[model samples]
Target: MNDSLIFATEGFGLNLNLFETNILNLAVVVFGLYKFLPNFLGSMLERRRSAILQDLKDAEDRLEDAAISLNQAKKDLASAEQKAGKIRNDCKERAEAIRLESEKRTVEEMARIKQGAASDLNLEAARVSGQLRREAARLAIEKALSSLSNSLDDKAQDKFLRQSIKNIGDI
Candidate 1:
């Protein structure tokens, strides 16, 4: 009976010592975590802040580039419009000049044809007048010969006819 009591008391003392050792180990681990936690958390927060700042700078650069491109596009559009206007004006002027030239040529051609027609009419009239003069002369000569033949006696006629023949031969 006395040996059993001593064994129980010895077991209780061992359990108390184990409990104290475990509590001390837990306090040491807590202190170590407290000492290192601030550095790890601060590094993580600074990395996140730097990444956000870089993204904002990139966005601003993109916006500026877009504005510059927009301005360049507007300038190109204005230049293209000016060139189109000039081309249209040149075409209109050329068309007008062509029309005027065509009109002038048509007028000149009409005048040339009229002058040619007038010259042809004058030549035809002169030819007709000359033909009429020749016909009248031949008729007058035939009538004069018939009248002279009827009026002259046979002996006078013979003498006049010989003299007329000699004059015709001389002519």
Candidate 2:
């Protein structure tokens, strides 16, 4: 039928005793926790927030430093590359100069060798001509000596000597 059995034991009993229900103690404990816990927890949370903000700022500063370092490194690399290029160009120019100097020296040496050869040839030719002239003079003198012995007797030699003396006196 109805729910009469549940309410048949007693009427609605409202217990207002503070010791039994512990409502006053609960209120005091909640009040103390509310007052003390906020001070401790709020200070801790503030410290954590400050630490996070400091970390963020430090990270940003580090990033800026890295950026500056990267820029400086780039400039240094460019400078090094330019120096290397200049050195390469200088080396090439020096090599070219050396080659030219070597060529000039080779040409000069060749010319000197040719001049020495020509001088030697001229000296040889002069020696041959002198020998030929001496040989011809000696042959002519021998032929004259043989003919003089055969054709010119004592009378002809005396006549030539007397005529040569007369011509010298007239001169």
Q: Which candidate leads the pack in lDDT?
A: 2
TM-score versus the correct structure, for each prediction = 0.57, 0.72
Model 2, range 48-153, lDDT digits (tens) per residue?
A: 9999999999999999999999999999999999999999999999999999999999999999999999999999999999999999999998998688768999
For model 1, residues 1-171, the per-residue Cα lDDT tens digits are: 333243456356333453545967887888877887778887898899999999999999999999999999999999999999999999999999999999999999999999999989888889998898889888887898888788888998899989999999999
lDDT of model number 2: 0.90
Q: Residue-pair clashes per candidate, as listed?
A: 0, 0
TM-score of 1: 0.57
